[model samples]
Target: MDLAVAHILSRVDVQGADVLLIDGPSGAGKSTLADAIVENWPAAEKPTLIRMDDIYPGWGGLAAAGEHVRTRVLEPRSLNQNARWQRHDWTLDAPAEWHDVPSALPLLVEGCGVLTRASAALATVTVWLDADDAVRKERALARDDGAFDAHWDDWDQQFARFVRDEDPVSSAKLVLRAS
Candidate 1:
């Protein structure tokens, strides 16, 4: 973990990356890594963080969330345009309020579907994280308590399809192991 954090910080320092995308399978610690980066960010003005988890409309929205991040967020931001994205209200299972993102601030997006080819092109840095299936499943279940219990198999299926179709790992500039 420390080495990963140091490597990310070094990337930011050397590359002057303004948009960092951390992506991987669920329970691979993408969110935890994002938190660490933000906490230790060198810049006084921290990057704005967005999680794909918030964009997923439901259990099967992995692909949709990835597209949304590419088109609505990364593309616009790359062109120096303000962007807005709608969040999925998980409890209500509906689209929620829009969140505005300015291109002026640095951005950090982290979650399961974030490292697609198109999205990677827009990001200044892209990371792929992974872990053994058993470890990942255990961590994911514990992290979400019982909310994700019923959807485990279904979500894993969707993720598998995403991996096969998008091959997001190929788009990553940096790859890390979570456990």
Candidate 2:
């Protein structure tokens, strides 16, 4: 674990007003960092986590998924209300499950498009993680057990477009090189 990561994790005061967004390219260790934060969080704080992968429509629905999360989850949550969004079932190729997100302070959202310009304004802290392309490809495919192999190139193209449009790293509070 990076010392900076540990420092950030320790400083997160969930009981107070806080919303952490972890965003990066696929296989950049965004999810891993988010998990570490959640794990190190005080149990009494009851931090809530929302993963963009679960909300994403599909492999090709990256842009749509970002918009969906913004409208469905972030919008409502900002007003201190419980929000609901259907989770896409990848295997079934449809949304087969409903996720009722409780209104929890200091919410942690982690994924590729979680830190767009609009979303960044809502987050108290945003961390961007990135790794080399070869490492990213290897980690991503292995993590998904080859399920994302076919879509790798397509997704990478979309991610590049998103980076060009949003420049999420520039908007982030911290940028970490995750190896």
Candidate 3:
């Protein structure tokens, strides 16, 4: 996490990065890394942080959420326009209220499926994080407190497809390993 923060700070300082994307397999520490980055951000104004968990419509919404961020958030921000996104109410299994992100400030998005080639191109910094499969599965299942138990295999298959089709690891500017 310290190394990731240092790398991101370096990019922000040297490249004037206004958009940062951190992506990884489930439970690979994307959320943890994002939290660290936000806490240690060097800028006077912190970037807006959005988690892909909020954007995903359901267990199978990874690819769709990625596209949503690309078209609604990253693309608009790249054009210097305000970005808007609708959160997914997981409990109700329906779309929820809209949220807006200011384009004038920096943005940090951390999630699976957010670091595809197109999205990476729009981002100032992109990261790919990975962990051992056993570790990731254990962490994810435990984090959700058995709520994700039923959907684990399904989610894994979908994420596998996303990884295969989008090749996020190759698209990322930085690739980090986590426990």
Candidate 4:
């Protein structure tokens, strides 16, 4: 791993009460960075993950159908350190029981739409990871099992809209070079 990059990343100070946003195109190692931060940083200083999907119903959802349109954002009061939530199972399309999601003092809301409208302006620190389109596709494909042709195609379209809105380089406090 890149120890230098990890050290640099650890130094970022969140601007305010809001947690940091790791904004990057898909497959730019968003979760990988979060995992690294958790692993490498001193336990006290490590930023725990507050996954955007964890706040939602399932793993692969921004919003479900008309009934549940980003419910967590609508009720931001419950999202404190003592938040009680059970993330939806996107693949199953079923609601789960309420579980306590301790609000980690320094959290990483890492994902594509994380930098989009819902959570964008609330970010304390916005770190954007830069990589070209081809590289992104390759990385994503590798992560999605062997060859994820259809997944990559759909992702390309979705990501275009997502990136258009976020434009992380323009939006983030710091744009980090991603390998």
* TM values, all candidates: 0.96, 0.92, 0.96, 0.70
lDDT-wise, the better of 1 and 4 is 1
> For candidate 2, lDDT tens digit of each residue in 1-179?
55756867765676764778888999988888888888877657756788889877888888888887777777888888777777888888898777877776578888988889988887788898899989999999999877899999999999999999999988888888877
Which window of 10 residues has the lowest lDDT sum in candidate 1? Answer: 8-17
The C-alpha stretches of model 1 lying farther than 4 A from their native spots are 13-17
Q: Is candidate 3 or candidate 4 better by TM-score?
A: 3
lDDT by residue for model 4 (146-168), tens: 54566566655665666675565
CA lDDT of every candidate: 0.88, 0.82, 0.89, 0.57
After TM-score superposition, what is the CA distance of residue 80 in candidate 2 from its true location, in Å? 2.2
Pick by lDDT: 3 or 4, better one: 3
Error of 3 at 66 (Å): 0.4
Per-residue accuracy of model 1 over 108-173 as CA lDDT, tens digit each? 999988888888888888899999999999999999969999999999999988889889899998
Better of 1 and 4 by TM-score: 1
Model 2 ranges off by over 4 Å: none
Worst 10 residues of 4 by lDDT: 65-74
The TM-score, computed over Cα atoms with residue i paired to residue i, of candidate 4 is 0.70
Better structure of 1 and 3 per lDDT: 3
